[model samples]
Target: MQIGITMFATDYAIPPQELAVEAEQRGYESLWFPEHSHIPTSRRSPWPGGPDLPKWYYDTYDPFLALSAAAVVTKTIRLGTGVCLVVQRDPIYCAKEVATLDRLSDGRFLFGIGGGWNAEEMEDHGTVFATRFKLMRERIEAMKEIWARSKPKYAGDLVKFDEMMQWPKPVQKPHPPIIVGGGFPHGARRAIAYSDGWMPIGGRGGDTLAMLPPFRQLLKEAGRPESEVPITIFGVGMDGDALKRARDAGVSRVVFGVPPEARDKVLPLLDKGAALMRDA
Candidate 1:
């Protein structure tokens, strides 16, 4: 299984470019930065991870910009948006950004996306809470059309655009791999429907290892092969046994979270993770 690292990419953390270079030198396969345009101060929606939202969530830099910095600095490590909230973004501009980054990275880009949880946050972006899922789907479809066609037009209920001309198409044919992030059945179903991969948070509902068989069965039910929608679990711990278990379960990738911190603090953890990856 491929091992990767993800960070919130805050102003105070080891900068994304430095981290990307370091991760690549250490033999990590990919480097991911998560997106959160802005966190609302209302605190109306509960965080799934815990009661209080972490400070880094409020301070994260734009994932595309951060990953662009990473892309320019590293040649081999694949860059990814850990979970870009497409529901909150304009698909046209987003398609341009994705294509630019993919071109800059020479086809080494992974598009990890999701329908985010923050209701007030989505509302601030002119997206409704209850229907955000549908909106996300439409936006993704629209982006796909933009990437695949020179003068693409899309007319979905939530997202619509006339045959717009855009340049710098993505280097990856049919665009970069779209990896949907969320918990199973719903998330897995969405991935099977539109995306190329599934990424569930580790320790969210139950063991991700336990969900593998059922997810594959769901893929079969949808007439999609397991190879078409590989699994990538995020927030994995640095445990050799767990890594082996994930590899045994046929997981394509496992991403470990690096806290937003200084280089002195983060490098040791990366070193430890690299050692574990060697053993894994």
Candidate 2:
């Protein structure tokens, strides 16, 4: 299985280009950047990770701009958003950004998307918390249509657009891989329905690898091949046994979580990670 890295790029953390260059030189397969456009201070919506959210969540650099910088510095490493909040953005403009990034990166782009967790944050973007998942799905579908057609039009319950022309169609055929991120079954179903892949947080609530068999069963039920909807488990621990188990369970990629820290602190971990892989 391929190993990738995900980091929340911030002012105090290692810069995107430096990380990307180092990651590529170390033989890592890809680099993922997470984003939180703006965090509301209301504290009404609970943080998903724990009782207190990390400061970096509110300090994240824009994923598109960071990844674009990464793309310029590295050639082989694939660039991805760990989970872009599609429910909180305009699909038409987002589609153009995706295509431009893909073209500039020589077709190496992975579009990881999520419905978002913060209720207040979604509300700030003018999206209702109750219908965010539906809106996310509609946005994904609409973006796909935009990428694939010269003059595309889509009409969904949450998202609608008239036929319009857009330039710089993605270098990848049709579009980049859309990896939907969430918990099992539901995310798997959404992925099978429209997206190119599924990404579940590693060891969240339970071992997501255990859910793969049932997920595959769902794929069979939908008449889709197992290979099409690959799993990309995020926040993975650096353990050989766990990696082996994930591979056996048919996971295509495991994205290791990197702490957002200064260069001196972060570089050693990156070097050690590369060394560990070499030793393995």
* Candidate number with greatest lDDT: 1
Question: Candidate 2 regions off by >4 Å?
Answer: none
Task: Find the candidate with the highest TM-score and give its number.
Answer: 1
**CA lDDT of each prediction against the hidden true structure:** 0.92, 0.89
Q: How much does candidate 2 score in TM-score?
A: 0.97
Q: Residues 15-42, candidate 2, lDDT per residue (tens digit)? A: 9989999899989899999879888998
lDDT, candidate 2, at 165: 91
**Steric clash count of candidate 2:** 0
lDDT string, candidate 1, 1-280, tens digits: 8999998898899999999999999999999988888888999999999998998898999999999999998899999999999998889999999999999999999999999999999999999999999999999999999999989999989888788899889999999999999998899889999999999998897878898889998998999988889899997778888888998889999999889999999999999999989998
> Candidate 1 local accuracy as lDDT?
0.92
